[model samples]
Target: MSLALKNEQYANELWRYKNTAGPQRQYFRMGLAAVLWRFLALHEGCVAAHCAVPGFGVVTTVPSTSGRDDHPLRTMVADMVGATRDRHRDLLTPAPNATSLGRTASPSRYTSSALWGENVLLIDDTWTTGHHAQSATAALKASGAGSVAVVVLGRHLNTTYGDTATHVEQARLRRFSWDACALRPWSHG
Candidate 1:
């Protein structure tokens, strides 16, 4: 679910070196909690067998490609209440040959545990080009996942980059609402 945005104006202070676990980290987690609830509720009855536990099998974050051990996002997810915390797992790790894998999608970017056909809800903190997220999905699928869904927390919008400035301008007209999804599903469009 590519629903949230991490724009500079509103979502600044997101985990930088000096300000690890940014001042507004709680807000981010709060928003994520709501988002996760909606997601699980919507997909509750649709989960299949061997999907780990109750549902969605497990909620795992994409490993930091930069090799930062024990990334803060994992801890944040681990502390989340309800089903999200209960279903968390450290499933994937960077592959042995994952060197120059840049902003291009490659299934071999990551290696995962034997899923044995579990439905996975893949979480990523920020989505820059979707390359890493997509790669993770492919890796999960290859590792015998049944259904894979990618939930990007921050669909980053670099205002100065290409059409993003225009996109932000257009988005400004609509008020942000938790009740309404930021990015509508295909059927709605």
Candidate 2:
């Protein structure tokens, strides 16, 4: 479940500015974190409403492959004072000597320590190609994590990039609503 779609001035700018170095960087990151805080506060009852699992036992964010010991996104989640604070754990990291992890979904992109079936709630600031997020999921599963649910802060859309413009046009034709559905990652497990 994503909080919202991000493009240009929407949630994009906040996400972008949060990464670059500066004095105002913390403010931008806080704004992005606020979105997550609000979502959990607003949908307090629906996260695990109809899902098989009781609730998420652990929360994690995609590790930045850029070699930061603690990615800013991970830091944002870590600094959260909300209920998510305790559940957050630094669970995944880029695989040792991984290659070709760019737009493609490859399990080799990340690695994690063995888990004891902790249900994981994987969060990411944005979803571009989803290669990083999906790869993190694969690594968690391989390491024995259970029922990983992905939640993106934003689904990035570049109107001028490839077929996205057409998809954006098609999406705009529909009316948005609050109706939500739960996607259980371990439906078949």
Candidate 3:
């Protein structure tokens, strides 16, 4: 997932900014769809929903690129729902954002029969500003869902280039560890 999110070179300007806006995060969600399904135990009782914005210009919609096949996010989602065969339906909500990465359209355009008879798990790539999730949840409710929850791969930390509001004030942090390479020039103890 980090591989997809990483750029070889990050600018000082880009570094200081936290992108609460959400496009990148959605991309991350797409990348992590497999793990999400397994984690949620999403087999038969619920449906998975994908948010469709008209012009966001995402190159790949599938989340996984394993075994030489890149399954689109939609495909992975369908698979997750399928794993729970007869358990739930899968719905794709298409709301054309006014522009790529624009705020989600009004919920008035959405209807719920797609997921009405069952619970739903709203799936997206990221959750920074959370506008998309909020709008989608409201739409799902209007559509008659019994319940709705969200699953995402990463949370936006508001760590923009200059401001560290999310990381500092919100206390969102990550820790990493590494083991020495087995090929190292040291004798075994």
Top candidate, metric TM-score: 2
| Per-residue accuracy of model 1 over 97-149 as CA lDDT, tens digit each | 67587789999999888888787888877777889889999988898987887
Off by over 4 Å in 1: 1-10, 16-55, 182-189
lDDT of 3: 0.40
Residue 183, model 3: lDDT of 31
Off by over 4 Å in 3: 1-31, 42-71, 80-88, 95-101, 114-117, 161-189
As a TM-score, model 3 comes out at 0.47
Write the number of the candidate with greater lDDT, choosing between 1 and 2: 2
Worst 10 residues of 3 by lDDT: 56-65
Clashing pairs in 2: none
To one decimal, what is the Cα RMSD in angstroms of model 1 from the true structure? 4.8
Q: How does residue 181 of candidate 2 score in lDDT?
A: 29
Q: What is the TM-score of each candidate against the true structure?
A: 0.75, 0.79, 0.47
